[model samples]
Target: MADAQRRIAELLARCDLEEAQHRLGELVFDAARQAMPRNLPELAQLAGLRKVPEMFPGATPTARIQAAIDTLSLAGGGTLVLDGRILEVTDTIQLRAGVTIDGGWGGFRAAPGFRGESVVAMRRRRIDYDAAGYARATNLLNLVIDCNRQSGVGGLCHGNAQKDRVDGLRIRNCLADGWVVDGGYELFGQNFEVIAASRRDGGVAPAPGRRGLVVAASDCHFADGVLQHFPIGLHAPGAHNHFARLHAWSTYYAADPPLLIGFLDEGEGNTFMACSADSPRLADNAAPPGRENGGYGFRSGGNAINQRLIACTVQLSQYGDAASLPPPRTIIPVHCGQVRATILGLEVRDYGSAGFGPFVTTPSPAVMRETTILGGNVHEGLPTNLQLPWSEPGRFLPRLCIAGSDAGIVQARQFGAVTRIGGLAVFELSLCLGGLRAGRGAVTIQGLPDAAAAPDEGHRIGFQPVLSHWKGGEPVVAVLHGGGRELHLLRQSTGAPVTGADLTETTAISVAGQYFTDMPGDA
Candidate 1:
């Protein structure tokens, strides 16, 4: 670049004024040739890229695209501009560094993309790594990558799972699938829809754990994408990710069970806002042979530590607990996570008319930061204790759910009602949502009621039992009002994991979907 600049100056000085102007124009053209391409097509030709169709016009589009990409990679890097036609390929095409496969040649969907076997792969195929530098900042913009083959195999785009083989890759405005962000760190993308992966048999029966996206790397952000029809929508197992306005639709496979919108294992400091998940079509989805159709909207644990789901909507279709399949299915089946998770302002609705799945199953050895379900409506009921939570009088007030089956009833023209907790009768309140396990004992109001006739019970009884240690702070104790009827919804507006209960009335919180919402599992 410096030599070219110097020569242009000397050439102009030696020419006459008219000749100088003409020659200077020529010099500018020569310099521009050495500069980088201003657009995608020019970039594709950087390394002597060729449109295989033009050279062999009757050849299959698959061969043309393969030859073009391979030739471009050999020539170094560039965008081999593809026409607006669907090409086909059999094997995974290596996406090279400084290469931009701009299917949208000019505007959006310009080239549309290839429909073939596998997808663009950033795998670590460049052996002697130290000798051959890895791919960097690869961009896939404005294209449709269709990897759905009739053969029922392949991924759309696969990243290196073992090492940081890619950095700063940006994928935007593309409709594609089989995304594995495992090996790439710092992938910034938005406005992309990942269609369901290659199904085992045209989706008649599900493939094991088919995924729309697996984000194992940290510091990744995705937005405005509809991830649908996979066993899991977003499989994130790292930290510091912000997901905004993502939709997970019909997550579970018909025969396969355990469908979830997203699963984060060992993931920390993540924020999920304005996300919605549902398994609407699973009403008659019987599991394959020995499998059961069960899953959650979202699940995190296994050192998943601190995360927040704010103002999200998790609407589960009607599902039932099957016979113990190796591990027993949780009764109040959704929203179960270990450790400190703070769920707030989420709309949870169960649309099952036959059998009822609980909004949140019992907390195992794990409890959310406070399990605050503030400012949301559960069409059926809030988190119910279908299984009684372990309790010690005056120490812990367990958050309970009303079983769907027990919601409406009539007995002697009287709807059962009570607002008190004393002796063994108080311990019996946890059983109301499932079956009335009425107890025999002398009952008294354990906590003072909101009364107009009596003096204020500023000394009203309440429990502040320690639930679990906060992810980045102290052990948090859930503050119960009355006899734990309402959860004091927590406000977690920042990236830090610290949460505080401020509001008074909240209903449902997320505990656990694609096929169903999922719990966090190992990568």
Candidate 2:
């Protein structure tokens, strides 16, 4: 094509007008012949290619792009290729199934400025659901949607029968929310960056956008994304979704509601692996009425069950001039509510003031049960590592009960060693009584920690005797009554202290029970 055009230009320059005109006609005919398919197979491949600028010349860029999209959709799904032009979209561009819009994104020249090839400067509208309320198997690749404070991408309605799914959706730079999925299923999104509008404008004021990515669907998979400057970077209230290598960060400036959270997870069976929630540049700001000023790295609540966070990190960067600024509010790294969860290899760091700990569990009437923190490190500088409502009386205490082994007894020799359940401490004890003799109608077990004692002297710690080789007259039940290192055992059935006469010299008894102690666990 270039050679033909160059030859025509040379011919016209040499004052050969007739020959130049004939050569232009021949070039046009050859171009038309190549566009027209020679065979059925060639026709099928050519039919799927629709270039926006070439197909709808003289039309507005938005109209041209939408016409190409509609034309490809009408042809039973095809690729709508943009000519690397910036399209100003003032109305919602409805997407259809089996159509892939390839907006030849040539990288952001000035990122967050929304300047680049194949960019859609959405004025106030969004690329949302079609008239049927869902668009399935629709893909978007190498596109940049400058939402201009409006929505970037929205999907299926709440009660839609068909699932709205986008496979292989890639946005290099998004000015607002990257996408919002409602009632979507099995959607795959990757390699996107969503930045808040305020950050893009270099403003200290709050960004009008709420979340970078909002997932209200199930079985969706998102990976390798950067979400920055949104109040909540990822608000996933969907179940069975997997997010990997996604990093969410807040800007230095504060928002109206305060730059609060990184990831707000209220979904069941959601897994976040190798993700990070960081507050690297949080400026001074007053929190909400009753809430704390600082933000949370990741918060899980609202009846969420079976959520797993594997090898995730939550960090708060240290301020350089700490004395100049007011102390940071309670910034909880990971806050889990009354839900069943497993946190493995979670790294939490706070280089600033000591606010809250790395792990915090809320005290509710429905206590958090079946929670496990396998291996994690809460670095120094925090006030306390594991903060739980341990003083909430019976409501929250017994929920973190520590059960014993196959014999239902944690050996008393391992008493000082902390046993954690959901990062809270619950100590179990099993004392072997063999050579110890009963004196003054009571057998005092020595070497027991003071935490093994009852809360008060009047409160007796109950115990059941596991008799292995009882000669005769072995006490079946007993209670420890003390507040010191010595645990004095008294027969519970008789309300009298166990005497040596009741037990033969060859008798063996193992006292086993669990107790709630004030000692904190290594969470």
Candidate 3:
């Protein structure tokens, strides 16, 4: 066993990333098969998997499970079978490498005796990396985790100097609730399911930043999951992750603005493939409005850059019972700010109140510069301002916003889609679109007139422009405006706008976008 384990380690050290994940997945499954009671006739079966049985004196499932894990780790790693006996977790047991928690979903019960804070966690550690057959291998083959308590699995990465880096982790067939995960590198989550999520002790509304999953690790993958009943379905605060065939439904309400997939805080270079996030709130339990009131289907917050959503659909509505009515006047299915978003085969629909704002909206043309939208449908389900003249643009906002900026310029290309932008007087246009800072920066047609009509037309317009770039200043007012086009200078607060006699059209421009240099092709 020792020789074989060492050989596997050597193989891992040599194989490239994809090959390593494939090899380790097979190895862990093989180990699990070998450890099942069917192979060891001495052990009894529970819930169709080998049962480790309760330990003496301390018969709690947590204690027995820990003891079994310790035993398995000391003698190399193997599978730990669970019967789902409603274990109440007071402390989290860190999983070791090469250990697979097999088949817990079949018998796991919730709402009766489940009292765990967070069922388990596996941090990136040297022991995991160096252990001959420890958990750096694929762990948790079939776990049904219920954080009846308040905590997320894979809590913030544990590393020196707080560098969040993780590698060599795999969790599959996990059906969990509460806050699900904070992700890790080289991590693969397959066949995962979450029916609901919250920090609610019993009822809802007390959930604190609750979500089904939060991916904060790069090079990680999550595929084939149905997540529902959470404020935010998946929040990616880290970069370079991939998600496929993920469905989030039955949205809950939150003033923080619920989103199906949200990439925020400078998280860049992520991909969503064949992903769909929508509210079944219209269908679930007769559509009493089921919580997730008006909000964005997918939104990119400040600094979120270079993301691709391919073959993705985001359908949201603010429809709910009177108790669930949203306060906002409109809802946006997709909003992108300061992002080089590449959207292909995208579908966005808004069916309820909180009138549909935009299929994809960005406040600054410079923010979504280099954006490309190809082959998609943006439907508001009614005669919307999308049809009205730009004059009545206040009735409904643009389907796409490419308002330019200060630090740089804006660039966007639409292969096939209905997008609108109006009121082009913007010198450096930026709009604080909504209630939350996370969802602000809406460019309005009513704006830009201030810049176009400014008295000084030589220098950049402090008034809003189609260009919305930032130069490390608050209320960033610098304009990337230079063309034979006249420049408008000064703000309403500072002097008057002036026209330059020798202003030359800009032949060269610097860009601010960080990601999506190469657009994502297909799922």
Candidate 4:
């Protein structure tokens, strides 16, 4: 028996000394007809799979899970399959390079409202990148990481600065967040839900500046995700990232000072496609005193440049009784602040009182220029004096070409020429008309500046009729009223008021002019 044991020991030691010891222990248990310990070391040798439950049997779940991870990592990196058990952790779980934790979705409880089968109930703990080491190819799959009102799993590339190029990271269905990606490249995340737990201090207001998913890294792609209950849902301070089919919902009533935006883009060269953001509801139909209370669906910060939104939607809801609510202050669907963007098929809807237009810009030191809205709908709850595609005087200039006809809004089919001189916007506007009666046609021209006064009695600007493709005589003169907000075609060649008989379904008109705008620049 001694010789047999020595041979077994020498043979096992040839593989690995520590592994040999675990094997020997298992052999002894098997020989004694007793069940072998189902510890991590033994199970790893037996099943070639590292599991959390097979760690130190008497240790806490956190320690056991960490031990299992460490053991798998020490074996040159592998997957740590989590058992369908709730592991309560009080400390952050540090992930090493090349390690993947896959808590199979099927392993967790399937009852409604169940977070997941493999749940990591974090009592202020999080799963983060290893501090002492650089992690590459680390992933979390099908795991529910509950923050319990503390921090959630993320910051994978934290403390490494932006110099490290951590790659091949993937997170799926983690149901975790406060997730910060400060440094990383090529991350592919899908179907992940980020929920900012309620504040522990029992305060109704959101923790000051609390954000759900803060991405400060570049070249990452996220899709089909939901970020809810955060002051700012998806704050992208990174560049060259793509977010597709993501929904951002903010319920925090307290204003976050300058703005409470669902999706705030301070990054450059990012593309949001088919994404939607639901603005936050006002608290008790009232905002804090001396503070503006309202939500913005999407905001492009002053530093944001070259951003693109394709077929995205933003909706602002009016909570409680609209009549009782204070005068709507800053409720805007999309606010473009000193940035260059190209928006296509963007739908902005407001369900509250009259507020800012669908797409608007406030006065800023830096100019908001080169913004192009290709196609979209701005559906407002109430008739507002603020014009569609509105911009404040002085530095807001956006080129808008609204295609397709909607009943209430002006749809400009195309723009012939748009140029700005000093603070004045000079352009030739064109509209395709199916049917027009020339007695007195009020045409809504896209890409026009807002009027300082009400549309009822606005500054009228004269425009020369460039050309028209109507069978009847074209209007010899055109007048743009309300600071170019409304265009009225008048005076036929025969000096007669052009009647509906002069126009046909295929008629098209073009007008050229330059108007003095309230914008500050060389007039």
Q: Write down the TM-score of every candidate.
A: 0.54, 0.57, 0.55, 0.61
Per-residue lDDT of candidate 3, residues 391-470 (tens digit): 22222222122222211111122111111234332222223211111112322122222223233333443333322233
Scored by lDDT, model 1 comes in at: 0.42
The better-scoring model by TM-score among 3 and 4 is 4
Q: What is the lDDT for 143 in model 2?
A: 59
Q: Could you arrange the candidates by lDDT from highest to lowest? A: 4, 2, 3, 1
lDDT value, residue 105 of candidate 3 = 51
- RMSD in Å for candidate 2, one decimal? 12.8
Give residue 220's error in model 3 in angstroms.
Answer: 0.8
- Writing each residue's lDDT as its tens digit, candidate 2 over 195-286 gives 65553345343344357778887888889888776667788888889999999875444332234577778888899999998763233334
Cα RMSD for candidate 3?
16.3
Q: Which stretches of candidate 1 lie over 4 Å from their true place?
A: 1-67, 70-77, 105-117, 124-135, 150-152, 160-177, 197-205, 251-266, 280-293, 317-334, 352-356, 362-374, 380-523
lDDT of 2: 0.50
What C-alpha lDDT do the candidate models reach, one value each? 0.42, 0.50, 0.42, 0.51
Clashing pairs in 4: 40-54, 108-117, 109-117, 394-519
* Global fold similarity of model 3 (TM-score): 0.55
User: CA shift at 483, candidate 2, in angstroms?
Assistant: 20
